[model samples]
Target: MRMILMGLGVVGRSFLRTLIEKSPELRLKYGLNPTLVAVADSSSAVQDERGLDPKEILDLKVRKGSLSGHAREVGMRGVELIRGVDAEVLIDVTPSNFKTGEPSLSYIKAALNTGKHVITASKGPFALEMPALIEMFQESGLHLLFSGTVGGGVPFVRFVRKCLIGERVLAIKGVLNGTTNYILTRMEAGLSFESALREAPGTGLR
Candidate 1:
């Protein structure tokens, strides 16, 4: 699978590491030869028509902050770069901007316009521009998958959209804040909010 990665944060770095570790199994079992064609952050990107070295990129990213810090023969910024790549799939894992969806939204739209399938974890573009994106992807026979958008791996959207396809959705209400829920759970165990927060590893959905 020829793919372009749009972000190199915690999730992106982990994805790269896991992809490298599982490449052999992926090819042997699933007959999928995954290749990292391009990698980008908010600043700049590195592209190789054949494939970029994932380890090298990851190491550079770890040493030097953003992708632009890496010494490169080629690089580009903004949505124009998305259109320049020749890849079958564009992985959009950039940070979500529920309010604006700026670069990520533009990147997804531009990639889809170029006939590349989009697989996004960002909820901003998908939540705000779903109608338009779905229309465009459907028209072009490409996918706009947002499997990791909400509630972590809870499958909340799938359960509502797929499992309850025929049923009507009247109201959606629940404790969406994992941090608050965790704190509340700890509070029940006689710990205060601040104590719970300090005890917890990191703030979630805050």
Candidate 2:
């Protein structure tokens, strides 16, 4: 599947790394070959419909700190990139902006309008405009996935939607933030709050 990935932050970089490492397994086991057609950060983007190198993209981000240095760099905003890319799916790992549902929200809308399925890790759009976004995707006959929004990769939304079935859910309780959960776990292991907070960064929780 051809895809466009937005956001080059920690989550985005880690996701690209994992995709590179697991591509072979993914193809062999699931018959899924994900090819990145474009990748964008806050300030810049790179596009290659034939397929962009995931490793090279990571290297560019690390060495230059932005995708602008790439030879295939494109001059376009996030929404424009979403609409212009000829991709089947859009993986939006952009940062959340609960106050406005940003650029991610706009990017998602453009993808849906252009008939691209969306898989987003950002939560702001869903939190603020779940009804409208859900309606948009449903009407477009495309999938709008957000499994990573609520509880990272735990599939909380999937569990609730599939496992619950007709069962009534009385209440829900859990730590949605991984960093905070890590600190709490450390505290349970007898570390002070401050010490746990200090140790969280080393574990790459955030």
Candidate 3:
């Protein structure tokens, strides 16, 4: 699978690192060879039709704090970048903009219209436009995956789709936000809500 990754934040960087580490295993066990052909951050974007080095991209982001330092950086971003890149899939780990469902929403629409599948971790788009997005993806005959939006790594969405085929779900209940769950845990352990909030940033919870 050829891919374009947008958003170079913590989730994006970590995803690149993990993809590099698991490349061999993915190919050997699943016959899946995922090549990152493009990457983009808020400031800049980069592309190579053959393939872009995930490590090089990750290192540039970590060292310089922006993809602008990359030699392949381009002027395009968001929807324009998505349309320009030649890739089978677009992985969007962009930050959530719940109120507007912006950038990522626009990016997803562009990718589908241009015949690219999508895998997104960003929640805002789905939260605000699930029905429309799903309809678009269906009409395009492309995959639209958002497993990371709700469960991080738990595959909760997949479980619901596969296991609950015949069953009708009346109610769903669980703690979905990790930051809020951590704060609640701390409060249960006797810390005040204010103290938990103060400690959250330092612990990288929020």
Sequence-dependent TM-score of model 1: 0.80
For candidate 3, what is the TM-score?
A: 0.90
Q: Estimate each model's TM-score.
A: 0.80, 0.90, 0.90
* lDDT against the true structure, each candidate: 0.79, 0.90, 0.88
Q: RMSD of each candidate? A: 3.4, 2.2, 2.1
User: What are the per-residue Cα lDDT tens digits for candidate 1 across 59-142?
Assistant: 888888767655553557657767887889988877778899876899888887788888877878876888988898888888
Worst 10 residues of 2 by lDDT: 197-206
The runs of at least 3 residues in candidate 2 whose Cα sits more than 4 Å from the true structure, single-residue gaps closed, are: 188-206
lDDT for residue 35 in candidate 2, whole number 0-100: 98
Per-residue lDDT of candidate 3, residues 1-206 (tens digit)? 99999988878888998999999999999999999988988889998888999999988888988888677878888899899888999999888889988889999999998999999988899889999999988887999999888754468999999999899999988887767887899999999999998887654345
lDDT of 2: 0.90
What lDDT, from 0 to 1, does candidate 3 have? Answer: 0.88
Report the C-alpha lDDT of model 2 over 1-206, residue by residue, as the tens digit. Answer: 99999998888899899999999999999999999999999899999989999999999898988988789999976998889889999999888888999988998999988999999988899989999999988988999999988765678889989999899999988787877888888899999999999888665454
